[model samples]
Target chain A: MAENPMEQFEVFKIGPSLLLNGTNVSLTNSSLFMIISVFLIILFFALGTRKLNIIPGKIQVLNELVFDFISKMINDTAGLDAKPYFSFILTLFLFILSLNMVGLFPYSFTVTSQIIVTFALATIIFIGVTIVGFIKNGVGFLKIFVPSGIPVFLLPLIIVIEIISYLSRPISLSVRLFANMLAGHTMLKVFGGFVVALGIYVGWLPLSFSIALIALEILVAFLQAYVFAVLSCIYLNDALHMHH
Target chain B: MKKILVVALFLLSISQGTYAKEGMPQLNPEFWIAQIFWLIITFFLLFFLIQKFFTPKILFTIEQRKNLISNLIKDSEDYKNKISVLENEYNQIITQAKKQAIDESLLLKVELNKRINEKKKKLADQLNIETEKVEKEIDDFKKKTLDNLPEIAGNFSTEIIEKIIGAKPNASNLKAIISEITDQEKKSRYV
Candidate 1:
């Protein structure tokens, strides 16, 4: 019988834990790696910006690159008033990007590869946008549900449609990233398996394909992170401006 | 919301077994737990670094650039004012120099004319005095010569009369003597 592809994804317990109703809440390999990723990201930025020189060293250069990139993104999409939100947006982008890239390592789990993880991120963004909308506009936040220029008779249906569209922001945002990462990784694993199954001569083809897919996956990882950030900015803009 | 429905439908479609092969990985609870924990940690750390270091430095640099530009602008304005003032002062100096030169030339011309006229008058007065003195001398010589002219003429006439009387005549002498006597008598009577 063929081995179960789902077997590679199982989370095994790694530490002793308190049992609540016979089930133990224990740390898993996935959790351990995630903690490590967080630590590494912290260490990187901490060391990167310690000097804060006018002419940046290698680490500071990288730090400034990220800073300028995110600042520009916010300024462009969200307007100058949104400068305050630059830190949050930049943090989101880096965290998601690092998590995605970390997942590509051998035997490492892609947190973004799972729907739950992406959904949590998307939900947070959704709540944030909603809060900002209400906070900025007060009772006028409902105006975002109904676009201007629709006829009176069609208004009800249009408003419903608009509301539905607005609510789907998180769903779309999360799924786009999650689906891309999951599909790309699965394809890589499949092709990688083919390299072993097919003997040496034909194996080279699948091996090469796997290599190419790996590179493509890395690109997709970065792209998805950027898309997520940009979309968030656009949503924030709608909230701030009450644009339909 | 329509968008939410669309996402639900999309998720529903992808939930099918077609995309999930027999050997494909399944979503487990541990993955979710790890992602949530790491996401929070990473987010806070990133936020702190941005807030503490990056933001302050960028703002400080921007402020410094603004101050530098303002200072340069002020300096340029001060320079322009100084230049204009210098130009005005230079023009004033040139005008004063020209005025002084014209005044000096006019004074010199007037002084020269006065000196020339004075010298001409002095020379005319000296020439008039000399001419008068020479004319007076000539007049004096002429008067003396005129006075002596009668005595010289009397001597010359007496000598001629003596010679004429010696050369000619007895009868005429007698008659002349008689006549002389008569003429003398008559002249005396007449006188």
Candidate 2:
């Protein structure tokens, strides 16, 4: 029998460990590619916006399209005051999106498929938003956890529930991305295995399904990035406006 | 700070336990460190490029367009005011020209009337002089004719008498003829 369909997700170490005081510290393929993706994103944007001319060239046009798109997104979701966050949000989106797309390549790891990576990103956003809330509102930041209009008697319980809800944000944010990428990739692999196992006559069906799923996965990759950025904007809006 | 420390300790313990699990792949700390390093690098680079290059250019273009529009508006307003002033000046010149023409015509009429009156006065003076001269000439011719009238009557009577009596009249008859001629002249003058 062929290997289990899910076994492809296993991580294997391929290099010697660099010992620092007898502790193993080493880089992996995943780390290497993550760094490479960041480098590429930086290079692309650097070259794209180098010449800021009146008439946009091809690269400049692409850059403007992305800039306009993100600016509009933040404006629509968080209002005009959110203009300050446009660059950060755009960068976050592009980085995540490119990582997701590169993950789709053969023999490459999906960094977001791992919980640690997604959790790390989500943690940064959560902490950043919380800091923004405190910085903007001072002691009034606690008001986010204690919504308005609740009776004094019910305030404590409600505040606790709100805190729990707030704490769950990172988990939900990370899991949503990780689960979608993991499930979609696993299914694609399973379908691909079926195409090889079954004869070419019956294999065409799974092959076609794989193709369709790949297309859907590509769309989902872009959508997940958009969702992540938009949610961050919403969180930032709550921080800035305290609209909870 | 305490929360961060607690979270770090908790993560470290969890990682240690997970590392002890048989057949499980080791979690590489360097991987995360590398990711964090790249993340900071990329974020700052992008932020600087956008802040320094892209944003300023866009804002400059927008400002330039605004200045251009304002200049055009100012120029148009100036043109409108100039046109209004020019129109007013044009009307003023036309009115002045009309007034000048009316004044010139009035002056010409006054000059023409004065010339006519002076000519009529000169003609009247010349006519009075001519009438006086003509009256003098007529009176002189009348006097000359009246003086010659006695001689002409005497000759006529002499011829008549020669024919009737076959001889010239004597001094007494001549005196009587002279007296009759004198009486007739007196009667014509009185009448």
Candidate 3:
């Protein structure tokens, strides 16, 4: 096992490296796991829903349950008008969730733990939502940053604050997911290292703690994914309806 | 606490790349482009696939299931309504048949009673005519016997005299004797 808990987060180039536009485009463990997660999601939905019996089988039940869960979540958060983008939001949630869960396995790479990957996803959402806002509401979309019914003197300050908060969305969104996964995995590795280093006689405490942490981390994984999806929905709602 | 210190030292030393070739590979700028590129490729491909194919398929299945259930319920309701209607018709038919049978029987009973009374009246009239004819025949026989009474009494006196003095009696006397005998018989029978 690697000595440093941080060592688990390292990305290593897997096949031959390629350079495009003066940037290295080499495939890495992160990409490999991302592909795996995508493949698993496809397989799950494809095979699970193939039969579509009136009385669903186990995998079919799981498929319907997940579908309904995301559907209801998006509907509640983004309203009925945002229904067209359900697939995109659901894909984002499943991809992140699968990546997080995959990271829990020993010797597995967590794609979401990388700031670059999360930032890329968050940036896409941010840019897409902004474009949607402009397209849907035209100049009225800018109203989101302006506070209504404020004292004349306080308008500028409040607008600046709102703009800052709006612009910081991508940063907060990306960092929250990346940091949660990175820190949780690191803690698990560190505690696990303790159990091994302390030996079996007195290591039971740390081992138990590691076990409990794993459970909590799993819960955290699910929660972070839910939070990420729900926040995206809220942003979409804002764009679609221009709620201040 | 000692374990925590050791773990912290290891993390710090790893970042320095003292023992490993890469410090923190997430910060190792060489792989960021590739990661983002692949992330985009995978995410959009997933998004398109789900949107175009999978989501629609599941939605269709759910729709089909709902329609199937509703149709079944509707068919059962139709069948229930149809059965009730048939039952109502059956009851109506049964009641109508019973009423018609009663009406027919009443008509038949009235016709039968009229026919019986007509036959009884004709038989009573025939019986009265036959009884009058029989009384007339009895009265004619009784008058013929009464007309022969004078001769029968003359003969009976002649027979008694011949037996006593060998001679006959007069016709008028015979007639008087017959009248006297008939009057005495009438007085004995009627009184």
Candidate 4:
């Protein structure tokens, strides 16, 4: 049998140990790529807007397209009151999107495929939005757990359910991105193994399937990033407006 | 260049851990803390970089470009309005000038006609006085000639008889004959 397809997700440490409070906080390939993604993002924006000309070049145009897209997404979902959070939302979007795209490369490790990474990100957003909720609405933020127009008999049950769902926000958000990346990449690896093992004689079928899967995976990568950002915006909106 | 340096530094930092470890290291509890540690560092670094530096500059450029476009449009509109106002004012002045010119021409024509009629009336009066004077002079000349006709005829007949018959005719008889002839000529001319 061919090598296991699941082996692609293996995380190996990249650098020597730097003992941080007795934890193995040594740099890993995941961290390397994350840093690389951040670098590329900064480079893209810095160079794109360096000229600042009235008539935009290709890089500036691409930069503007992304800028406008995220801005519009925030404005549409979160309303004008959420304008203060524009930088945070935009940064979150660009970071994840860059990581997702970088992950698509062969022999590369996808950081978002790790549950810890996505959960960390989701948790950050959840905590931040919760803080914002409290700060903006004070005690009234707790009212989100209680549905209006519910019968007194069902109030306790519905509120419990609502709170549970609210708490599960980070898990669902993180798992959604992690699972999609993991499955899509795994399937592609499996198909790649088939192409190699079967050779040229019967490999064409699996090769074609791999091509289709790659295309779909690219789309999923972009879509997952979009879903992540949009959901965060919606959560922030809930906090800002306290809308049910 | 700075971005490339940052990427290179990151690569250098992580280059030491490319060693093969057994099984899926992602599931290994030994690596989770490290992964989370790196995740926090990377996420926040990127977030601050973008938020503080990249986002503001890009949005500023876009906004500046938009403001430029709107200002250009506004300036062109103002110019158009000014041109239209000037054009309307020019047209009004031209119409007023044309109306004034026409009024002046009409007045001049009325004044010239009045002057010509007055001159024509004065000429007619002068001509009537001169014609009356000439008519009275002609009446006096006719009266004086009629009164001298009998004497002038008696003298001329006496002279003519002496010359023709070698004898002078009687003055009174010739006078009577001349008077009778002149009376008959006068009756023929007058009646």
Candidate DockQ values, in order, are 0.14, 0.06, 0.30, 0.24
Assess the local accuracy of residue A158 in candidate 2 as a C-alpha lDDT between 0 and 100. 96
What lDDT tens digits, residue by residue, belong to model 1 across residues B71-189?
99999999999999999999999999999999999999999999999999999999999999999999899677655655554555556666987643344344444544544655686
Per-residue lDDT of model 3, residues A64-173, tens digit only: 88989999999899999999898989999999999899888888899998888999999999999999999999999999998778898999999999999999999889
lDDT winner, 2 or 3? 3
lDDT of 1: 0.74
Better of 2 and 4 by TM-score: 4
What is the C-alpha lDDT profile of model 3 across B98-180, one tens digit per residue?
99999999999999999999999999999999999999998898778776766787788778877897666666787787789
Clashing pairs in 2: none
In candidate 3, chain A reaches a TM of 0.96
Model 4, residue B81: distance off in Å is: 0.9
What is the C-alpha lDDT profile of model 4 across B1-191, one tens digit per residue?
A: 43344335334534644422443334455678888898888888878887788788888889888999999999999999999999999999999999999999999999999999999999999999998998888878777788788988888888899999999898888888999999998899899
Off-target runs (Cα >4 Å) in candidate 3 are: A52-55, B1-25, B84-191
Query: B51-168 in candidate 2: lDDT tens per residue?
Result: 6766566545445656878899999999999999999999999999999999999999999999999999999999999999999999998888776766766777788888999999
lDDT per model, in order? 0.74, 0.74, 0.87, 0.85
True contacts kept of 4: 0.65
In each prediction, how many residue pairs overlap at the backbone (N, C-alpha, C within less than 3 A)? 6, 0, 0, 3
What does candidate 1's lDDT look like per residue over A12-112, in tens digits? 56777534465544566655655666666666777775766655688866766787898889989999878778877977888788878998998887777
Q: What are the chain A TM-scores of the candidates, in order? A: 0.92, 0.93, 0.96, 0.97
Number of backbone clashes in candidate 4: 3
lDDT of 3 at B33: 88
- Write down the TM-score of every candidate: 0.64, 0.62, 0.71, 0.72
